[model samples]
Structure formats: C-alpha cells, structure tokens
Target: MTYSASMAVQRLFPTDEGHDLLDLTREVVAKELRPKVDAAEAAAALGEEFPTDIFRILGRAGLLSLPHPEEFGGGGQPYEVYLQVVEEIASAWMSVAVGVSVHSLTAFPVTTFGSPAQREALLPGMLSGHQLGAYGLSEPLAGSDVAAMTTRATRDGAGDDGAGDDGATDDPAYRIRGRKAWISHAGHADYYTTFARTSDARGRGISCFIVPGDAPGLSFGAPEKKMGLHCDTVREVIYEDVPVDAARRIGDEGQGMPIALAALDAGRLGIAAAATGLAQSALDVAVAYAKEREQFGRAIASNQGLAFLIADLEAAVLGARAAYLFAARLKDAGRPYGKEAAVAKLLATDAAMRVTTDAIQVLGGAGYTQDFPVERYFREAKVTQIFEGTNQIQRLVISRHALG
Candidate 1:
C-alpha cells in the first residue's frame, strides 16, 4: 500500500563523497521522483507525454552527469558510484533511471573518443545537466548488428572548397540521411549521438556524429505505444540531409563501430544496475505485502513455503546488485570490462525477470491487478532482456571471450 523510503539492502561506498552522492540521490528520489512516478507513467501510457521536468530536476541536482569529468560540468564520480546512484533512482522510478542511463550513453562517445577540441566544445553542454541526449545506433533493420546499419553520411562540398587547412568549416561537411529506430527521448533530446555509414566497407565504414536536435532535415516518427516504462518515449529519428559540421564528429571517419562497441559495454552495466533496482523494488513490495496480508489465521509470510519464495527473491536481488557492482568496479579501475559487462547484463536482467515474476506470485491475485505496482514492474522487466544487446547476444559475447 505504501512504498518505503528505503529498502533493506545494505550499501557500502568507497569514499565519503560516494556516501554523500547516494544520500543526495535518495533525497532527490524521495522529493522529485517518488511523488510523481505512478501518475506520470499512467498518463504517459495513454498518450504522448515525457517527464522533461523530472529530468530537469535531476539535471539541476547534478545527478544526470555523475560519471563524467567534473571539469566538464559532470559530477566526476566513478562508475561504481554512479551505478549505485542509478540503482537508487530506479528503486523509486524505473523510467527515470533508464533515462539517466540513456543520457549517459549519449555523452559516452564524445567523452571517450572525441578530440580535445571536440571535448572542449561539446562536453560543457552535454554534461551541463541542462541538456538531454538520444542515442542513434539501432535501426529497424539492424537492431543488434551495428555493422548492418544502412544510414549514410555523405561528404558535403562545403568543406572541400577552400574551407581552410585548419579543418574549420562554416558550412556543413556531411549530410546524414537515414532513420534510427527505437531512439529514446527522440523528439525531446537536445542532441543525438548518431552513427551512420560513411563508406562501402562493412564494419569500418561507420562514423559517429553529434547531431543537433533541431537540424534542418531531422524529424521524428510518432511515439510507439509500449507495455511499460511509458514515460521513456521512443520513436524513429529521421535524418534527411541533416547537415553536421566537421567538428561534430566524435571520432575519426570509419571508426564508429569500435566506438559504438566500447560504448555498449558501459551501457550494458547501466541497464544491469537499473534492472537490479526494479527487482529490488518489487521484492520490497512483496515483502511488505507478505508480512501484512492475513491468510487463514495468520500472515502469509508466516508460512515457510511463501516465506522461502521471499527469501529467494531477496537473494536474486542481491546477486543482481553484486553482478552489476562487480562490473562497475572493473570499469572504474580502467580494466577490461566488456565480457564482465555482458555477463552482468545477462545475469541481472534475467534475475529481474525471475524475481519480478515471483514477486507477483507472492502477492497472488493482487499482484496481477493495477492496484499494485508489481504488474508494472513485471512489464518493465521484460524489455531489459531485449535491449542493450539481448540476453542471447550477451551469451554470444561471453562465449567469444571464453573461447579466446
């Protein structure tokens, strides 16, 4: 009937700053997200609505850019700390947590692969918390295969014709014309971190660009009706001769594939953290219900059969958290975390699916009803396994690492 301010799960931070950051995150979650998530998600499911205000609230609080450089207006926290903050946010609102993750993903290429000049120019706005971003990687035809994207970026003559040897062009240098599918915050983002093919070469042909949201030929499709996470609006980003400056490109031409792949490794850990939070929320709700709901002559939780199920749910949530945290620590240490990121994503999302299902079972018929949030949690959990590289794709990634 009521959501707790905090769950029973214990957290340990590596520093006082980490502790303070989480405390700030919890304060924001309590004040900003918890009060509006239910009504917002319900309203968004019926029509086109996005919680731009909530993102603004997070942005103003410095929560949106926690994992980037401080000099660039980010919080400059380590990934481990950042992910825990995401988990805390997700415990109250999954959509916002996902938005945070997606926003972080959009800035990744610029932060990781951009030239010093690009970082100096772009990082200020991207990490300023006043702006939101969308990732333009997946297409309708190329969901998991980055190399299969057909979006093309042809060179414009503006740069070739006496544009100065310094690579400074007043006019656009490339025109991106293609559609990016399933882009979150499509119409609402301030910028899009886009990838498009620049040549005929299969994998090496792609290039990354930071496309302005209001580009002349850029447009969006109608929002897709979805089962859950309604406030995280998704639609097609149509780029029809969307002109981009030479400076907007994040990495060198023909280097988009490697950039995208590297970014995905970090993105997977974000989803894993969020899934764990969702599962933890479900478990908390189930536990509270089990302790109160009377059956026969006593509480349902008094029964060993049902009690064991709750125990298992706790374990699942813990394991999921641990998996993501391990991956986050690896990333923070500047170690190779791609395989571990895949493993964490695979384990945490699958755990989310199982734990949420069992939580509903723990509630019996009530969990299936809209009166409870478990049903919504169940719906949200299904997509985590599908996005950020599906579990099947994750297994393949793991297998490749194992074989090598």
Candidate 2:
C-alpha cells in the first residue's frame, strides 16, 4: 500500500482537465460563493431562506453535473476527477461543498437505476442546476438502521384504496404517510429521492420514490439548528396521506434499501474528498502563518516544533488524498469499492479533524477568532465523520468486509 509521491502530487496539483475544472470552480467560488458565505450563514442563522439561487449559478458552471452523462449536460468526468473538484471547492467554503455533495448524492439513484423516461425527464432540470435534489431515506426511527423506516406506500389500484372509481384521473395510486428526518435540502429541494415501506417484510418492503417537494400532503418542518454547515438546510419532511402514482416509484418494491446503500457508497467518497480539501486548506493557512509570524526574533515556522507539526499535517493531507483517489479509481472501474470507500472516509475525516485542530494550534489565539477560516474549517470537518454513516459505522463496515 505504499503510495507514490509523484502520483499523489499529480492528482492534487493537476493536468489540463483538472486545471480547467479547478480554474472554473475557483472563479465561481471567488465571484459567487466566497462573497456570499457570510451572508448565507447569517441568513440561515436567522431562519431566512437559503440562497438556492447560488446552486443554479453553480449548475450553470457545470460543477453540479460532473459525474452525470454528457447527454444530460453533465461534465462526464471520472470519479477521481470529480472528487478532486469537490475537494478544491470545499477548501474554499464548506457549505457550498456540502450542497454540491448532497446534489451529487441525490443524482446517484436516478443515474444508476432510473428508467430511460425517468432519467430523460428528471435529469435535464436537475443536472442543469435549475432544480435542487435531495435524498430522503432517513426517518425519525431510522438513521443507521434504514430497515426501520415506517413510511408506508399501500398500493391501491384505483377503486380499492380510495382514489376514485375512475382510475384514469391520476390520483395517488398509493397514499404515503410518514416523516423523514435529517433530510438535507429538506425545504429547499425541488424533488426528493425518498424511501418507504411497501410491505411488512424487514428489508424487502422498502421502496424508493421520486417525491416532489410540492406534492400534495407534503410539508417541511423547521430547519434544524446545527453547529456547522448552517447554509445547508436539514429538517423533517412530513408526508401525510400524500398521493403518488405508481409511475413516481423509483424502482421495483424492495429495491430502495440497496439503492440507498449504493448511493451512500458513492456519496461517502465525495465526503472524503471534501475532508481532504478542507484539511489541505487548514494546513496552508497554518504554514503561511507560521512562516510570517516572528517570535524570539525568528520566524515561528523556522522552529523545529512548528515545522514538524506542519510537516505532519502535510503528510496526513497527502495520505488522505491518496486514500480517496484509490477508492475513486475503484469506483470508476465499476469494481467493488465499498470497503475502500469506508476506509477512505474514515482516514480522510479523521485526518481533517486532526489537521484542522493542529491548524488552530499553529495560529495560537488568531485561529480561534471568526476572522480565521480554520475555525470554520474545523467546524465543517466534524460533520464529514458524522454523516455518510458515522466513522464508527465505517469501522464496522471495514472490519466486516475484511472478515468476509
């Protein structure tokens, strides 16, 4: 598992395609995202509407559609390339990174399993960034245990369930009733890739659906007040006897759980890349500060203690980059990448937490202030470990896969 320094550097530094993506992404961030980060944060803190308009701008830049088909107006980039783009964007602002990651996660099911009609109909707006999409698998009762979801979709063919005698009217052939909690883009997304119970079977009953945000009987609760990623809205989606036609169902019954898990496998890689980028940003800040600030009539960075610390952070960032790149390559090859993805997530997130903390230590009192980006980077790093399945769950996945 020895990593080549040249390859790692190449991946991080870039070539023509990479440079083009990075330049385009940085310009968008500089022109649009960076100036608005504070404004977006303040707005979210005050219970105001998030700037959904920014997503449309990003979509116009091709940032939102990197991994999708070119026929759908996506970038058609490989996972390795896509993750690198994610890292660079995240290094600038964690919330935008989260939005990009969530949208990418939402696109997974549709791209992988949606019917031709569904893909053709749904992806144009979504990939174009006109409509924001969210994944809705989590419930009040099910977070880690997706099988425990209680949202039910009882199939009623026209007359039996209660729609009407005339089945031709397009009433919800099935009524949806349940609440999904911790849904990213809960209130803002135009559509949600949701899951529900279609039967009494444990895992077999689960089914995925394309639930529109404006669907009848669908409403959002207040957004959750969280410590970080404030710009990204997370809340509960209540479906109270909502009508949905059979056509809206994502896949055949019992396919939802696997769809959710596979989407997670892809999403975790995005989180890992973002974590690596965040850590890299923190390290850059620490190193620049250490070199400029003088103590004892000498640059603090010249001191062995500070030098060693910065070096360690650099090493960790490189390692994290390598780990995610390996996982991304596996995914691009259409190979089994679950265990590798879990390892990448665990290592990259842990590295981000450690590196961001040390970055604060490097800056002394300055790092603790709102003026420094490291504090925000530190706060943002925490959720990377918690979401996309907790780091503890990642360990379990790695160990279970190893034993198997």
Candidate 3:
C-alpha cells in the first residue's frame, strides 16, 4: 500500500544527467506536487485559476524552465531530462503537466528560430515565470490538416508599426486576422505563438507570429467545457487586425508548417510522457485499493481475477513508459523523431485510457464516484487522447512516414 521507488517503477534511461533529473523530479513530485493535487484538482473543477504559488514554486525549483539555458533563468536541463521531470509531475497532476507542455511549446519556436535579438528580448520573461505562453496554430478549420487554415496575415506597406519592445516588429509587418480554437492557456498567457496565412492560397502560404497578449484587437473567447485537464485553461484566441512585425516571426515566411510540426513533434513527446505518468498513477491507485479493500474475508489483492488485472496494468504502464523514453532519447540526440513522437503519443495515451478504465474496475462501484481519485483519473486521461493531435491523426502521421 506504500509507493516506493521500486514499486513506483521507472526504468532508468542511460544518461548520467538524465538520471539526476529523474531523481530530483521524483523528489519534487513527492514533496511539491502530491501535497497539492487534491486542492488543485478541486480548484480546476470549479473553473478557478491554478494556484500562482504552485507555478512560482515550480519555477524556483527550476522545474518550469528546464531544457533551456541557465542564463535565461532556466535549468539548462536536456530534453531527455526535462521530459522525465514532466512525467513525474504529471503522475501527480495532469493540469500542471499540460501547463508545462504548453510553456515548453510556447518557448521552443522562439529559441529554435528567433533572431538573436528576439530571443534576448523576450525569452527572459518567458523563462523567468513572469510570462506564460500559448501556441495558437489550430483554427476552427484547421487542426491536423493545418494547410486549410483560413487565418490571414496580409503584408501591409513599409514603415509598419508592428514591432513591440520585445523586438517583434517587421519592416513589412503583417496584419493578422484569425481565430485559434482550443488554445491552451489562451486567456491567461502573456504571449501567443500564432500562425496565419501570409500569402495566396493554401500550402506554403502560412507564416508564424509571436503576438503579445495586450496587442490591440487580440482577445479570447469563453473557455471550453472540457472533460479533463481542467486546471489548464482552453479558449479561442481571436486576432482581429492584430499587428505582427516581421521580427516577431520565427523562421522564414513560408516555413510555418515545418515550424509548427517540429514543435508539435516535441510537444507530442511530452504528452506521451505525461499520459504514461497518468497510467502509472492509475495503476498505483488500483494496486493500493486491491491490497486493502477486503472481499470474501480476504484482501482483493489475493483474488486471482484482481491480481491478473493488476498484472496487465503493470505491463501496459511499463510499455507506455518505454515507448515515450525511446522517443525522448531520439529527441535528446537531435534525431528526426516525427514517427517516433506519434507512436509514443499514441501508445501512451491509449495505455492511459485502458489502465484508468481498469482502475475503475478494480474499485468497482467506488471508482464510479468522486469519493475516489480513480474516477478523476479516468476523466482526465480521456483528453490526452483527444488533444496534442487526436489518436486518429497520430495514426495518419505514422502511416505517412512509413509510406514515405
């Protein structure tokens, strides 16, 4: 009935620094995360904001900005390590898990393709916990099929006043007009890495922009009533003639798809790690319940049927962990991991769905109510399969890669 490192079960990836990140991450989860999970979940379900103190505490612990350089107020941890940290936190709370993934997504494109000036100007706030970010790529018309995005970014004449103090001005800055749907942290973020069509027609027409939250004509619609990860906000970001300078743009003019996809690739890996963690948590809850919940004058753990269910969950959780770790290793080594990312996301999320359902089975009627956390885990795990690209879309990505 106790959770130990041995019973908690994470296979160590073979990196010295990675091991350190995992150890520290487990400590952070046990101390900082587990204590606050019930309160956080309660607040989230009430549609209240995540505790700002939690974010600050994570920032102070160097959990928020891992995988970025120390100069920018980050932990300078590698992606492999950062993902492990994400998994640990996610095992405790899915909302915090999604928030960190969104943060990493918001910062990645800038660090990868921003002009040095742009990175120097804006990254400090992003890394310092002073600024939160949302990546706005999915529109009402475009989710997995991003080329269909109708959001337009017209090139205005020269001397455009699109630049802000963040070094995001363009000589021929674009005027963005679009609605990004299901944007995580939409109303709450200080900035959004949005994509819009800058040229004629579909395909290569899209371009990226880093729009500030206070930009004129920028606003968010009402939050979505979601099934899970309710701690993280999701809304539609509206851009009505929002000015965007070329300086705010990351990568080249026709490079939106690649940039978005690459960032999504990394984001998917984080999601997989997170989903695996959720599955693991569900397994833990089921195991604990089976050990203590007596039936027929004996603990349910002694029953053959319940014992086999626990065994199956163990295998599934381990498989999911291995899937995500393999993807993390590839990404850490700077390899092309598009297919691997999709696979990790798909398998891990599916495992979460299966394991959580079985967790409820273990608890019988008790799992069906708010009296136990397993039902909440069941609800929360549902969204991981839907967002970060649907499981169906992940399959498409994998199929396309295999064919190509």
Best by TM-score: 1
Task: Return the clash pairs for model 1, or none.
Answer: none
lDDT of 3 at 292: 90
lDDT of 3 by residue, 1-404 (tens): 45432235745655686677677777777788778887777777777565566667777777788877777787777677787788888888888888888888989887787766777877888898767789999989888788989898887767433233455333547789889999988878889999888886456788888888888889889888777777787899999999777777787787888889889998998899889888888888888888899988999999898899899889988888888888888887888888999999999999999999999999999999887788888999998998889999999999999999
Span of 10 residues, lowest total lDDT, candidate 2: 1-10
Model 1: per-residue lDDT, tens digit, 1-404?
78672456688888899999888988888888998999999999999999999999999989999999988898889999999999899999999999999999999998999877777788899998899999999999999888899999999976632122333577888999999999999999999999999998867899999998888999999999999999999999999999988788877789999999999999999999999999999988998999999989999999999989888888888888898899889888999999999999999999989988998999999999999999999999999999999999999999999999
What's the distance in Å from true for residue 219, model 2? 1.0
Is 1 or 3 the stronger prediction by TM-score?
1
Cα RMSD, model 2: 4.8
Q: Residue 174 of candidate 2: its Cα lDDT?
A: 76
Using TM-score as the measure, name the better of candidate 1 and candidate 2.
1
Which scores better on lDDT, 1 or 3?
1
For candidate 3, what is the lDDT? 0.82
Return model 1's CA RMSD, one decimal.
Answer: 1.8
TM of each candidate vs. truth: 0.97, 0.92, 0.93
lDDT of 2 by residue, 1-404 (tens): 11111112354433478678877877787778767776677677777467677888888788898988889878888888889888877776777787788899988887898777667777787788788888888888888888888998877666223212212235566778999999888878988888889988877889887777788899999889888788888989999888777666666777888899999999999999889988888888887788888999999999998899898999999899999999998898899999999999999999999999999999999999977777888888898898989999999999999998
Candidate 3 at residue 266, lDDT? 89
